[model samples]
Target: MLSTSGTIIGIDSSTGACSIAVCRGGTMLAHFHEDMTRGQSERLAPMAEAGLAAAGLGFPDLDAIAVTRGPGSFTGLRIGMAFAKGLGQALGIPVFGVTGFDAVARAVFATEAAAGHGIAVILESRRADLFLQIYTTGGAPDGPPVALPPEDIAARLCQEGAAPLLLAGDAADKVLAVLDQASAAMLRSSLITAPDAREVALIGLEMAGDGDIPPALQPLYLRAPDVTAPRAG
Candidate 1:
């Protein structure tokens, strides 16, 4: 368990956006987010500096670091994890890893809109398939997240049930398109949403307080990257 009342900085560059937040005692002191498909490596540190400045705090004041350990953009995930680990190492502070699923699901669980609805989180893979996880109305994961074609995902959700469902994440619409008309008709969506660092901080604090921090924060890549091998020498 954490010794202090928790002053932490959360960083997320797991999707198209780069975001950072500073929270002390479970309240956000400052946050910054910008949507960009690239340039997180160049911009993340300056943005962290800005968040610290806006919060009227400095690096020495932080008790821990929290970051999204992703099933997200491969490049984006590395940018965030590297920044958080480097800073934590330099400052001698523990770093906590929160999943991309929990980061976005936290927002949905807090809203009244989520009542009476199962949640299906669909993350973009920048490929033909997508990353998906389902949650009960009360916010427990139905199973592990997986990368699957839209049709397969639709089939799985149908097996789960056809109750009113809420679809979330950047790729919600693509899943909506592939669902059977019955499932499609009972759905609501929050397509503009992406994982935000503000929630990352809160979730991290909860994880730490419960002594759930991992020994190592590894990237939660749902599938391998789409890299091409170089030509033979």
Candidate 2:
């Protein structure tokens, strides 16, 4: 008989999407999601509580807490990390970090294959740039994520070889405009706007089950914060 590994909570408050999930081993038991334009601090914890309740568990019953570590909205990232850290510390359980991009990529790949080309997941950064990454159909990273000016991303896509690409994430609509023009004649595209917390939870549980927990869980901030104070003239 397989021994139970207890429950895990996956929290993702990245982009405009916020979600919580409960899982055991690699199976997701319950999930909650919301499209919050503001107030993640207010919603995340309650959502987590609800998800745990739905799974018939509580914070004390969780074996681990997993969260999306950035390359996303700074406020959202901080809220998620803080909540996970506090919960884990209180319960004396381990807390792990997964990338926001990777979480969305996993959800997309779980649904389809990148048979002809590659996949790109884009998340809107409140700046003039977009957060983007390319991945193989099997969820392997093709390259590091970059915060690029919208036009530059379009140019790059046009230059890449003709392969059917799948696009998804919080910034799907904005990214689609450029991608559509770039790959207008050759590439095919599909969009999934939100990342699934259930998928994130399952992936996190799998990693934890494999003893792949890293000591430091940090968010993937691709660029400096937009609010830099100008030097005095």
Which ranges in model 1 have alpha carbons more than 4 Å from their true place? 160-163
Q: What is the lDDT of residue 167 in candidate 2?
A: 69
Give the clashing residue pairs of candidate 2, or none: 71-220
Off by over 4 Å in 2: 1-5, 113-116, 160-162, 179-182, 228-233
Give the least accurate 10-residue stretch of model 2, judged by summed lDDT.
Answer: 181-190
lDDT of candidate 2 over 73-100, digit per residue (tens): 7888899899989998999888878887
lDDT of prediction 1: 0.87
Q: List per-candidate RMSD values in Å.
A: 1.6, 2.9
Whole-model lDDT per candidate: 0.87, 0.76
Candidate 2 CA-lDDT value: 0.76
Best by TM-score: 1
